[model samples]
Target: MLWPNATRVLSKMGLLARLAAHCDSNTHFLVRTSSGKVLMKIALGDFDVPAICVRRADLLAALLSALPSEQILLGHEFRHLEQSGERVRIHFADGTSKEHDAVIGADGIRSRVRQTLFGKSDPIYRGYLIWRGVARYEGNAIEPGANSESWGAGKRFGILAIGEGKFTWYATLNTLADHSDSPDGRKSEIQKEFAGWHAPISNLVDATPDEEILKHLAYDNIPLRRWGVGRVTLLGDAAHPCTPNLGQGGCMALEDALVLAKCIVNHNSIQAGLRRYGSLRYSRTRHIQQRSLLMGHIGQWKNPLVVGGRRVVTNLLPARIFEHNLRRVYSYELPGS
Candidate 1:
C-alpha cells in the first residue's frame, strides 16, 4: 500500500507516473466487522496526494527499470565489512571485496550489514501468522479504489484492489511462530480459517491458486538507538523493522532513501551526512514503529467484551479525530521541500 507520503516521495524520484499507470488509486478506507458491517470509514480522496495499491512485483519492476542494469549486481551475498578511515570495504560470500566511500545497508529485516555493525539480535515474533494472495476477483463488493479490513476474534483480513480486476487479500491470525503448512494444504487451511467471514473473502481465497498463497510469521525488531556507525549506515527494515499493521514498512524505506541521498549531498562529509540522516529520521520512525505494534495488538483482541468495546470506540470516533491522525502521517513533507 502506497500512502500519500510515499507517493509524494515516488513523484520526486520520477517513478510515480510510471507506477500510477498500473496501480489502483484507493479513494476510501473502511474498517468493518467480520459480518460485513462498517464500523468506520475514511475518505482517502480528501488528501492532497492519492493513495495507491500495486502488486509488489510491479512496484519492484518499476524501481529496477529506472536504474541501470550494470550498476545492479545480483547474487553478491554480503558477508561482512571493514571500515578504515574514509573507506569501507565490503566482503561478499564469493570471496570478492569492494571498497567504497560508504556503505548503506538496505538488505532488509535479516540484514548481514546491520548484524556486523551492531551485535546480532534476532527479530521478535509477534505471535501471529499472515497469509496473503492475489486473485482476479470481480464483484460489487470490491468497488474500484475501495479498500477494507474486517476484524474478527483474534483475526483480521484486508482486501485491496490492485487494478485490472486483481485484488490482493491478506488474513492474519493469532498463532505460534515457526509453524508451517504442507505445500498443498496452504490454500485449504486459509479457506477454513476465514470461512464465513464476509462476502468476496471466501470467493477471493477460492479464486486464488494454491501455489500463489504465501504464509509468513509476523516479526519485528526493537528500534535501534542508533542506525549507523562511521561510514556504514542502515535503511528500511534494517534500521527500524515494524509490523505491517499500518502498511508503512516499505513506505518508510522509500522515505529513507530520499532523505539519505539529500542529506549526503548537502553535508560536507559522509559521516556528518549519515549522522544528520539518523537524527532527522529517528523520532518519526520510532513513533511509527510503536504505533504499528499497538495497532497489531488491538486488532488481535479475542475477548468478547474487549472486541465489543473496540467496535464501539471505532464507530463513535469522530471523523476529524481520525483524519487528524492520518493527516499527520500522510501530509509529511521531505525536509526543506
Candidate 2:
C-alpha cells in the first residue's frame, strides 16, 4: 500500500502503466521453497489481518515503460559530495552524472544516505536478535484458520500466513553478552534462548533449514533534529529507523510518500517541498523510532527481575492507551490520502 504513491508518481510521468492492489480473491502468489507444503495464518493486533497481496514482479511489470530506456539504475553506491543551499551533492558508482530536483533517501538501515547526510552513528542494540522463517503449516494450528504470534517473558513469536499453505514465523530471543554477526552463531543463540519454549516455537526452528532461518540483530537508530537540507532529504530508515516491535516502519514510509507528494504539490519548488517534507515527517517518525526502541528494550529484557516487573505493569497499562497510541499512527489520514 505504501508503494502506491511512488508508483503513482512514476505512472504520472509515463514511467509506469498502472498501480493496483489485489483485494479480490483471484490474486495469487507462488513461493518455491522446500519447506514442505506451506500453509500460513497471520493474526495482527489480536485480529485476523486480511491480506492485500501483490507480486513484486507484477508491481515492476506496471513500470515496464522504463524497461526500454534502462534509465533506472540499481546497485549504485552512495558517494557523498559537498552541496550548496539546503541541498547537497551525491555521486553514484557508475560515474554517471545527474542531480535530482530533490534527493530522497529511502534506503534501508545501514543507510548510506543517512550517513552521507549525517555522520555515522551507533545503533541501539536491544539486547536481542530476531530469527524468522516461512514454513508449511500442518493444519489445525489456528482455530479460526488464522495466524498469530505469542509474546513470552524474554521472548516473542510471530506467525504470518502468506496465502496458499505457506506461513512465515519469526522468533525473538535475548542474546548472550557477546553476539556475533555470523548467521550460524545467531541461529545457535536463538535455539539456546528458546530451548524450553512452546512446542510450536521449537517446531518452527526445527523446520527452518540453516539457510532458511534468517538472523537479524535487533537495532534501531535514534531520532535526529535534521532530516533534510534544502534539496536533499531522507525518508524511511534513512531518516528514522524504528524497531519492528511496532510493525509501523513500512506504514510510516507509506505516510511519508503521501506527505512528500502533497508537499511537492503545494510548494513552488522541489527544494521547498523537500524541506517541508522533512520538517513535517521528522518529529512523527522520530517519536515512533524512539518509542519502538524502548518497547523492544522492554520486551526483550535479559533480566528476570525486569521481566517480572514488566509483566506486572502490563495489566495496569490501560487498553485505551494501547488503542489510542496505535490509532495515532495508523488511523492518520494524510492530507493527500
Candidate 3:
C-alpha cells in the first residue's frame, strides 16, 4: 500500500510522531508452533521496512480530524444510488440525497454502497472466525519489534505490540459460519479454545477486558469481474475484500485510496479516472487477495502431519527467501513515488 502519502499527511498535521510513539515498530515476523517453538523468524529489519501498527479507529479519527470540518460529513447511512447523465446520485436512508461527478464506495465488507452498485452481492465466508483484542501487559511482555504468530491444528494465535505495554492479539479458529456468538460468549469460547496453548497466548486472553474483545467471521469477495460501472465506482474492501491472513487488507485499501486519487487528478474525465484506477488496481489487489486466501488455508491446516510438514518446510527455507517474499509486498510504491 502507498503509505508515504499517509505519512506525509500525518506529518504535515504533526501527528505522525505521536502515532509512531504509540505504535510498535516490530522488526521481526516470527512463525511458531503451538508448543512455542519458532519455526521461522524473518528479520524484517534487514528489509529496512518500517512496520507501523495502529488501532484502525485511532488512525481514522486522526485522519478525519485532519480534514476540514466543512468538507466532512459526520453520520449518514447510505441507502441507494442512481446515475443520471455524467453524475451519480446517492440517497441516504433518511431521504436526503446528494450528487457527485463520481461515487467511490468505501462502505466496507457489508457495504450498502457496494450492493447499490453490484446488486446485493454477499461476501464468501472462509470457514473460520477470528477473535481480536488488546491487552495491557507489563514491560516488554510482547517485546517491541517482535511480532509472532503461532499456528496450531485448525487454529492460530498472533501477538504484536501496538503500543507501550500494550499488545494487540488475535486468535483464529475453524468454525461453522455465523456462530451468532455474543461478546461474552466469544470471550469464553476463545479462552477455552486456546487454553492449552503456550504462555502469553493464554495470558493475553485472560488479561483482555470483556468489552474490548471483538469477534468476527472471516469473509472475502470473490475477485470482482469489475470494480466500477459508470460514474459510480468502488474503493477499499468495497472493491476487493480479502481474508486477513496476509495482514494486508487495510494496507491494500490505503493503496487504493492513493492510486484512486492520483488517477482522478491525472485523468481528463471522471470516467477515464475510474477506468485508470481500476486498471491499475485490479491485478495487484486480486493477486494479494488470492495470496491471502492461500496463506489462510495453509495456516489453518488441521492435520498434524501436514502442519508438521509446513513447519519443517518453513524452517528449512533460508531467511533470504522469506525476506524476498516480504520485499515483494512491502517494496511496492505508488507509480512514481
Candidate 3 ranges with C-alpha deviation above 4 Å: 1-15, 45-49, 139-143, 182-184
Candidate 3 lDDT at 198 equals 77
For candidate 1, write residues 138-191 as lDDT tens digits.
778876667999999899999988888888899999988867785558888887
Q: After superposition, how far is residue 154 of candidate 3 from its true place, in Å?
A: 0.5
lDDT of 2 by residue, 139-237 (tens): 564333343445566777766554455556777777763666555564565677667654455666666776777777777777877887667778777
- Number of backbone-clashing residue pairs for each candidate, in the order shown: 0, 11, 1
Quote the positional error of residue 124 for candidate 3 in Å.
0.5
In candidate 1 the C-alpha lDDT for residue 42 amounts to 78
Pairs of colliding residues, candidate 3: 26-145
TM-score of each: 0.96, 0.74, 0.91
Q: In model 2, where is the ten-residue run with the lowest total lDDT?
A: 26-35
Evaluate model 2: give its lDDT.
Answer: 0.61
Please list all clashing residue pairs in model 1, or write none if there are none. Answer: none
- 92 Cα displacement, candidate 1 (Å): 0.8
TM-score of 3: 0.91
**What's the alpha carbon RMSD for model 3?**
2.6
